[model samples]
Target: MAVRSWVNAFAVIILSVGQASAESSSGSLASSVKRLTDKFMATGAEGTPPGIPAISVAIGRDGKLLYADGFGQASENRPATAGTIYMVGSITKQFAAAAILRLIEKGATLRHGSTLLKTTTPVSSLLDIANDWTLEGGPPITVAHLLSMTSNLPNFTRRPPHELDPWGAVPAKQLLGGMKEYRPSGYPGSFEYSNTSYFLLSEIMENVEVGGSSRDYHRILREELFTPLGLSDTGFGGDSWEANRLANPHYRRRPRFSQPDWLKGSGDVASSVIDIFKWNKALMEGQALSPQMRDLMLSDCARVDVWTYYGMGWFISHKDGTDRFFHSGTVSGYTSYNLIVRPSPAHWVSVSLLANSDGVEGVDSLADELAELALKS
Candidate 1:
């Protein structure tokens, strides 16, 4: 589960996990809702992935956190809790997207030098792209194309002769530079998920030598998005993660997911359920970007499949009558999910799930179950 940056689902939070429900704030969840969670999420998962032993969930409605809880164990003795931190992999993309928009909104032109960076601007204009890459017929990839996942750039992750070793933690610049060698694998207009597209976007952002805008991605995120939004608990792995109760990677080797360098703007951020809920509320309520840019970011920029559309950092899809805007993340020893559902413009609900193990699909399925019940209740 790299990400659904889609994460595979896992079991519900009803288990032998330390704090399980002892410290959970479940008053807002109706008895019926709890029964529904107990019925579906009730049992099915035996905590298969030995590495993935804990799952935490937080729910928000109308603009407030309605419920927050954890299931399973953080370690042999430690219990996963609402405040438990997990490396939210590609969920980091959302913060990266917000940083880009916020920088643009702060009167800083989205350009590094001669190029006037706008949504319509081509990738060739921003970075020193390879000459061989081509659409073969149509227009070249643009800022909007990259943001919406229409840039058919090759994904180095799935390759026969890997450009950068998928397991090696390279820097963002190295990843982007490696992408220069690969020609366009598909047309520039179709939906294709590529981390290189975002690496390029981050480079473009970093190169924006404006009045005082830092060239660093992490610094930009901390200054522009996290600090301004009051998200103190959300930060990069190696930096701010250890200060809190962290869900360590659960593999036999038990290596940490600390190397986010190559994954910089792509899938390298850590956070908690409570902090995630606050982020979703602030983002959807227009506190993140101006209404115009926010709408564009959430707009159906490109279709992912039959139902899902790729927006800037989120996926937009529909179930029954409700519209959902969300993203998920997966890293070693971790899996994460974020969701916002609109039953109507006036009604809203959000859910954030983080698990310590991988290979479990229940995490994704559990999110669907919880979101549906929350919307109805």
Candidate 2:
């Protein structure tokens, strides 16, 4: 499977938002969480050979940063820090979803050829999508369906005739030309993981917002979320990211999807744990989206399992006393996981783990462990 397909498809455990009071966090709880995190990193992402070169984690509780840390080397010459920027894979989807919903909420519109269309406009109406994009006899796919991964469209990233090479460059025209024919997978209103869905969502955003001109997802994010949230260390990978400053992806390095225009909004974002935490904090605490939109982002989820739901750009997990919302991603040699777990009504926590290597075993297990620990403490 291609790296982009692994974004939201990798979470295998129950996890969500979390946090505790400052007073309690200053003592044993703080130490406990930190120690637990350190212990996990001690094994270097567990079971992966030439294992994780470096990892950064940011944990929050009650809207406050509880623990922020880094482990291992970012590169031979530098040690990783909480600030080291790593390609944050599919976690980029949340930003895209938020941008779309925020635009929708504010009645944001963009030119689509001769007409102007708003965010709520049907995707079929916004872009030149295939007729087979939806299941037979079903209604045309909408912007909301694309955002929520309920579009039931077959994935283009790993499927035949359109499998993408994330490590190579694909021109915008060639990429769009490939989405011409798609056989629908799964059923309507059911949760099915599809990287192609977000790709379509992003095209809708660009064409509608920028009139489908150039690759401007990075600019869109900066203007909409990063700039407003003060996320200075976050952006798409490339010249914007100084080679020495960005964490060197381990295991598989070089030819590393340098031109990620093909990935687009599906998996092109690179960010730090600190900045990601702030974004999550603002999001969970209502700064990023209105309450109504936040509710939709989370509650629009369709149950795919006993405990997990595929919501708009995130997975909703309600299990083992944890009300969790999260997403995980990978591209080339990086693995990213961001989570929010609420142990109780008044307490919520978010943990973000950014690693330089692709196979970071126990990523979700670590999340579950933290949630279990938070509840017990």
Candidate 3:
């Protein structure tokens, strides 16, 4: 996890030369981005893990990739690069949410030909648990409730010690079957972060249709979001060439293993810093979603606390009079953070960070700091 801060002057010079037009267009903000990202990765400090085994960062301003760089080893032998893929946990939810919105835009109704749109469909129509379980007179959950993490679904991670392997391969059916033991605590409209809600959403998307026949969630995402946005490196993890390029996952300096297939839409997408930047830019440019859908995705639907709100797949916050949309993911052996700051109509800045080791101090802080720096620049 030790990282040597040897600046790649040659690479910088080449990138600067190649991006002269972009620099001119951004009016010196590009230079500021480059300077800030050059120091983005942290050298391990006391109480923190030695250093990030592999860290990749990308900064975008006004829908342009201003700076991107990688540090440390992607694997045992491979040096980190802009294309080194890492499992980006809950950030995958954004793509899933986008796919749902795409289906809605295509005029897809809920299962059973219900007139309800994607957001209004009741959870009972999609999954068996909603019918079998009761919430002590609470209202039935809806698609909007799940999307906003207000479904009051029981968090599987809170299961007894025997079920604490958050990254282990648990079948989706098995996970759902066990939910009968617990009852919903919070009301349907109250905020409760639940991966199960998204997992069920994934299931619903697979069985329902937009235009004609039903499609798998992964296929829907690929066609509607990744392919259109040119996110070539992002996909489900498995024994594939893309998987081979994954920066090895680690926890406390020990190598961690890969996740199973059942995570699906909740947290099972992998991508590099550059592709993530592309996603943020596509979002900003209205390429991935219509203007109304984009507003819906970014709108604050449920309050997480006094200062934070949960939108469709994003956490919305405001700092110093600027609006921020962000999400962080933590699975076994990996942690990631993505931040987008919209300070003005003409300015948008995004920062994406992927790290191999779990519980790494400063990963989130570094992303926030870089976003702030990009905004100021």
Candidate 4:
């Protein structure tokens, strides 16, 4: 098992590039992208233990692919390609959030009394607080709460070191039962990101849908969110993806870390750069979701800080007087980021960067570099 300390360098950042002319003007930006990509691979290739085998990057500026490249090999034996798959860590949150919204579109609402009650799986003791769970906390724990991460539940990621699982497997139900009994760290209105809350929500989704599986919800997403949006390559766990379309796993201070099967809904979806770009375009164009649902996705769920804002399932940034909606994911050996500017739908861009090494360490810095290059050009 490998552990990431979430050091200062591992933060994910999203920067907005003004609506640059979408003409044939990515030459200089392409060069900068190459420089950043080169820098990352250079460090990894020359690491003390020699970093993982490869890296793949896709950058979209103002809704266009300014640059996409593959560095190193996608697999230890196979050469990496532009479409390689990568484990997009917590970035899976927003996608899960989007799936929840699809349920709402189907007439299922996240009301006060509605929750998943009857499932054979044992719930974790930590989640017992949700047992007597009424929707009394501020705004009822709607699918939105799970999305914005303000349901007042504790984020399992922030748990004590011994309790957190870098690569351990505990029954999902056991973890949920534990959370059920545990008291929330803050009021519902307070901003607290909890993977436990989403886990519970995933269960509830299972109850609402015909089949009791988060995979079913993803199946629905395929129709409501993915297919219509042309995101053929985006899919939940257990899919047969193209060999050339998957990024090899990357780690830091460790050789390999297998992701837990139970963490599927929280962060186990596999995706490609082109797939995310298509998803971003659909989300911006209101193709995957209704205009109303789109607004709900951006609606502020909680205020994390004076500068950083959060909405249902997405992060909002108000910089340079422009508002942007975005999210980032960090999974074992992988780091991913996506951001799209509102109002200026054409000003949409998504970045998917993967390395066969713990590349997320440079997420924020790389995002900054990508944005600067894209916007400046």
Best by TM-score: 3
Instruction: Pick the lDDT winner.
Output: 3
Q: What is the C-alpha RMSD of each candidate to the true structure, in Å?
A: 6.8, 7.2, 4.9, 8.4
lDDT of each: 0.69, 0.71, 0.74, 0.58
Flag the better candidate by TM-score, 1 or 3. Answer: 3
> Which ranges in model 4 have alpha carbons more than 4 Å from their true place?
1-27, 43-52, 109-129, 134-140, 158-171, 210-215, 253-260, 341-346
Error of 1 at 250 (Å): 1.7
Residue-wise C-alpha lDDT for candidate 1, range 1-377, written one tens digit per residue: 11111111212332223222323255435343455434433453564433457777887777756567666777777777777778887788788777777766664554445455578767776678645545657777777777877777776555512555655566666767667777665655888887766766678787664574446777888878888887766887776444337776665444432454666777778777877888988887888777788888888888888999999999999878878998877767787889888888888888888888654456656677777666654
lDDT of 3 at 352: 93
Better of 1 and 2 by TM-score: 2
- Listed in order, each prediction's TM-score against the native is 0.83, 0.84, 0.85, 0.76
TM-score of 4: 0.76
lDDT of 4 by residue, 187-256 (tens): 5557776666566656656545423333444565566566767666677645666544566565664522
lDDT of 3 by residue, 34-76 (tens): 4544454444434434456778877777876666777778888
Taking the tens digit of each residue's C-alpha lDDT, what string does model 2 give over 133-153? 555467777777788787787
